[model samples]
Target: MAVTIEILIIILLIILNGLFSMAEFALVSARRIRLQQMLDRGEKGADIALSLSEDPNTFLSTIQIGITLVGILAGAFGGAAIAKELEGTFTVIPEIAPYAGIISLFVVVLIITYFTLVFGEIIPKRIGLVYPEQIAVKAAGSIVIISRIFGPINKMASLTTDAVLWLFNSHAPQDPVVTEEDITSLLEEGTQAGVFNEAEQELVQSAFKFGDREVTTLMAPRPDVVFLDLEDSFEENKEKILTSGHTRYPVCRGGLDSVIGVVSVRDLWSQMTAGEKPDLTLLIQEALVIPEHITALRLLELFRTATTPLAVIMDEYGSVAGIITLHDLLEAIVGDLSTVDEPDEEPGIIEREDGSWFIDGMLPAEELRLLLELEILPGENEGVYRTAAGFVMSELGKIPIPGDHFVLNGIRFEVADMDKRRIDKIIVSKIRHRGDENPDEKTDNHTTS
Candidate 1:
């Protein structure tokens, strides 16, 4: 009967140990943001859970104390009680009688340790991890009460830990956590595991890179920007405006540097249809001016605050650098926006039968990098230049004329055509290494203007 009572007490201690283990794991793993969301939704015990999580050290100290005490008591009472009961059974074997007490004690210790480790620790921890929020909320109130009861001991333990850490010069520093990289890594792993499809992975990766992009990297270059001279009459520029296929055009005073404002095609069309001479200055709305070095994320904010669809990018010297529209910024986040009009000319990138690529110089270096799968470009100076032409110019230290060629990192870059001053077309081919007999080469045929 005494042995039965002892066993029951050990079983109770094991259960208590499991509870403390569960509470500790659950509290540590529970997301505070998720708890606050639950609290906002009027979920029960979420507030308590959040409060406990905020001062985790105190509540965790309480759990540690409970677990330690239960373990000690279980080992002390259980080992002695079980060994005493087993001594009678060992006495029947006369040869082993001399070592029976020690043998019984060892057996009892092993049984207690195994049950405590499996049922009390491992299983409970797994359960806590699986249902952290639920277990944490349920355990929060009890742990808070227990912590208050053992406040003095918990305080002493915390102080001791702090003192020891200070003595060892091991103060924990709160570093800025970057969760985007972690999420990106997880998404890549998920793709490999077939949990995420190719399109889903690309969208997620694009979202992560969106905040890091600069306006210069995404903006249409100055040469590509179609604008109207304020000095030109409505009749003179009507053909250009109609053929441009753009909704808005920057109305410049003399050149791109002397720009005044933007003219919407809708306003011009209305005036033209009404048989009224459109006053260019009166029809123009003020253009939003953003620095070229500004990030795409910041550019979006400025666009929202200014309530303008298009912004003129300015260099450090106050000259017109490029132009960016709201559509361009959205494309940076969600990928390219398709246009309705089909152009008569061919696109900038063309793939040949020999597996070589014909690329346009105006394509952004980032876009080219994605196309070619190059780890790093030879002369790619980020923020200094945006396009593949700029990268080649930086490397060659001059404008590359047609037929100018160079080799970098086992890839051959040949200027196929030059548009007067700027590089127009480049032929890119891989210089195969000695032993690579048949490399599986694939090229992205897509082009960026």
Candidate 2:
């Protein structure tokens, strides 16, 4: 072949190699969520891109085949055909004439390799990775056509791969899925990029975890529940309602276990404001009963269908476990919402002046982890326990009594108070060590309690 034709063919091969490199990297880097979004908008070739990305064997085999062929042809043909032409040019210098063939072959290989690496691999793959979804959509049609052409060969390659894996009693791993960590990292990255504020990023992260969290973690456990008794006179129940300052009261005849209905303070106050007698019985409405094990997200949906936001969470034993509200679910998503019912003095977590903490027994483990700066809490994955009290019970393997304490992750949890068998108040302090560690967080549960 002529030197000009040989050079042109090598250039064409490099361009083909670049195309294959771009397609392979773009498909690999393209996120399924972004591709699905593009498809939802009815963008042309998006569906094909999504399909090609989802089937790695087809598109991958096709790209590998194209790249392999391009490399072979470029190396083999450029050396035999173009190296002779280069030798003729090198022979012009008589001093190097005898060594022209050797010099020409080395020069040809070096130039081709350099161009192939830069234009064919690095640059194209960088472009692909930087704008993966967009490039995937744009190249989707061409890639699909190539995949179709190589379908039989692709199938054979897949079978060979599977057979090798079968020898090891293993199969190829499935493609990656979007995980909580992936979304969390994205949210944090957005925060760093100024796309979302820190609070907004936290809200999104919490919302993502909403479905995975059970009601038990977020509920006001039975110990903290303030109820009205039907056996008590209206004046007695009124005192309880005014003292607790809660919006709704579970109206129980016997106890929390025998909750008959819920009564709203608004109803009683509305009648009183209208200069009419407040009748507690007339204001009572049946509370929605839900299993304690149900997710907070599912309960959020359930609230949408109910007449009132209040619900009684029943344990597997059919006894009332706790009470929850739509407000509770919203607070879980958006952080604490202070209401007329919630007294400012009684926050769930309180940092003492001594740097120790006064955390309520009902506080969720997730929130505790954030407050304590701990990596994880025990039994979080298994749903074995949800609250700080539950954590204490699990660690101790019994109902903890007042003054009982334990240390974990350098934090000492002391059972400061107990309401019957249930934990009511916890004194959380750092276990300080006399060392180079930060003075505040180190040595005997540092609070001189």
Candidate 3:
């Protein structure tokens, strides 16, 4: 019966103001990494605080209503108390008491507004943001109570917000993509926090670069590829198997060009115990095939989908260019192939006592680039070439003879070794002086056939 309209209005304002603060806290609560960290450390309320933040509208509405109610109560109590204190001093005319009441009311309201804005809204919001995960988890228990108290109001706010967004033709993405850069950043952070070593970080970064690499970059060149001749006697195949040190070999009748199927060591051993000549046809498993032009990333996907372990890489003419295995692809992503024998193509940077570089002839262009940190290797052309020798022959536009030391760019190349068709070994050294003229700069100075 004693309740005044002023008291009611103050109560409503306090509740609304509180609701505004709560909304802000809820919206940003979950994103607070600090709060999440606290929650992870077994903080009782921290987890709840983060959960409340996940649906900010509900938490915010509830808090806003509660704070608004409290703010109004503070204003009302102050105004009434002040009016009572001033009653005799300012009430010479009874009508003057109403104006005094109005002044007291405005002063109390302003004070309450200042404190509420500074402490209740701004301070809490700032602290919550600074320690979101921790704050959310700690506030989780309280947020639940607030949610229950203002359930209807929370629902209304959420519905209204959703409707407004829908009207604007805006919607949140489902299953947002985690970008390569995001993963890299996370890995970098992990590295800084000692979760990963330098080598591991480099490997991860290289794995991401797999998309730009082709199958040939990691393939065992055709010369180094081990295969079982279909025409060879069972004993001969067994001898090849024992000496070759391979778990799997292509079953080729003529050469790599006629590779029909892949023969596994398991199948070979199984037949050897049976006391019968192992039939090449019966022993071979279907070969997983791919083209040389296929990107290593796509090849990895193909390996996953097919559930096959090996793929024979061929050129456009259908000739087998090289062999790639699941182990090769894994090595591309992780490290060295564990089971596959290192191809006979050992391109070592032999630091001889004479101070001359004795680089292996069978060295791959990629290996050369990696070791020398040079960018001389050409990209994939429509030809079946993978090694430095293949690259040199490609550049020369003819078969490279044994006694040739061609200088290109600032790097000098001496033919150390050569086979019938390709250059197997080459020795390269960085020249101190600019060669006669810049190869790229001279209009007609580019090396010709």
Candidate 4:
């Protein structure tokens, strides 16, 4: 009967140790955000879980003390009581009687250790991990009460631990959390594992890259931008507006540099339908001016708050560099919109039959780099110049004429066509050589024909 009581006590101590271990693991692993959400939904005990999570050190210390005390008591009382009980059982054999006490003690210790390791530690920890929120909430109140009862001892232990850590120039281990890179890597792995489709993966990756893109990278270049000259007559402006088919046009007094405001074609259409001539001054709306170096993500916010669809990008000298629309800003996130109606219109890159590429000069350098599969372009000043034309001009240090060609980094760039002084089209072809490709290789070959 005494042996039975001792075994029951030992089992109870093991259960108590398991409870403390479960509480410690569950509370530490529970997500605070998840707890808050549960609280918002009026889930019972979520608030208690949150309270315990907030002051983790004290509650964790309480659990540690409980586990330690339970373990020590179980070891001492279990071994002694079981040994006393087994000593009587071992008296049946006279030969075994000599070593029976030691053998009984060993057997008792083994049984206690096995139960403590499996039931007290592994099973409880596994349960806590699998159902952290549920277990954490259940264990929170009990742990908090225990912590309060041993508040002084917990404080002393914490202070002593801190002092010892400070003396050794060490700190407590922080909770392991996922980082941005880890999330990105997980997203990539998910894509490979069929968890995320291609379009979904692209959207997520685009979102991550959205903030890194500057306004200049997405804006229509100055050469491609269609604007109205304030000095022009109503008929001239009306003709340009009809031919261009653009809804919004920048009103520049003198040239592209002297942009005053933006004018909407809707306002012009209203005036024309009202029997009044389309007036540039009256149709113009306030233009939202943003620095060229601003990010596309920030531009989206500015557009949202300003309630403007059109914004003029200005350089450091306050000159109009280019223009960006709401559609342009969104393209950074969703990628290029399909132009199904305009099939004849040339894309940024046109592949030829001879494995060469005819690229638009205004195509973004980053896009061109991807198409060409080149690590670095000739002259890619990340902020200053973002387009292919700008990159070419930067490399040559002058406006390139038609038929001017140069080779750099195993790729050959030839001016296919030029619109006045501006580069309009370029021919990109890969140069395959046995040895190192010469960067100074220049040719007057216009490869378009």
Per-candidate clashes come to 0, 3, 33, 0
Screening candidate 4 with a backbone cut-off below 3 angstroms (N, C-alpha, C), the clashing residue pairs are: none
TM-score per candidate, chains pooled: 0.78, 0.82, 0.53, 0.70
In TM-score terms, candidate 3 sits at 0.53
lDDT (0-100) at residue 379 of candidate 2?
Answer: 80
Q: How much lDDT does each candidate structure score?
A: 0.81, 0.84, 0.68, 0.81
lDDT of candidate 1 over 1-449, digit per residue (tens): 88888888888998999999998999999987788888999988999999988777788789999999997888578668778889888878999999999889888889988988998999999999999999998998899899889999999998998899899998766753337776788799999999999889998888777888888888878888888897777676777777877888888987889889998888877987999877877788899998888898898888877745899999999999899899888877776567653134455578899888899887778878877898866546545567888776666566767777666655667788888888888888776864532233222111122
Global CA lDDT of candidate 2, please? 0.84
Tens digit of lDDT per residue, candidate 3, span 1-449?
Answer: 23365455545565455445644554564555655676678877766666665556667666666666665566446546544554556556676776766665566657666766775678667665565454455556766787787788878877888899899987865653457897899899999999999889989898877777889877877877878887787788778777878778888886679988898887767886999776778877888889888899998888876634888999889888889888777767775544545445343467667445777655556666676676545552444466677666665667767656655555556677776675767767655645543433422223432
After superposing candidate 1, which stretches have Cα over 4 Å from the reference?
87-99, 175-208, 230-239, 276-282, 302-308, 341-382, 401-418, 423-449
Clash count for candidate 3 is 33
- Residue 429 in model 3: lDDT: 67
| Residue 206 accuracy (lDDT) in model 3 | 83
**Model 2, which residues run further than 4 Å from truth?**
40-42, 79-100, 147-152, 169-181, 273-275, 316-318, 345-347, 350-358, 369-384, 397-403, 409-411, 416-449
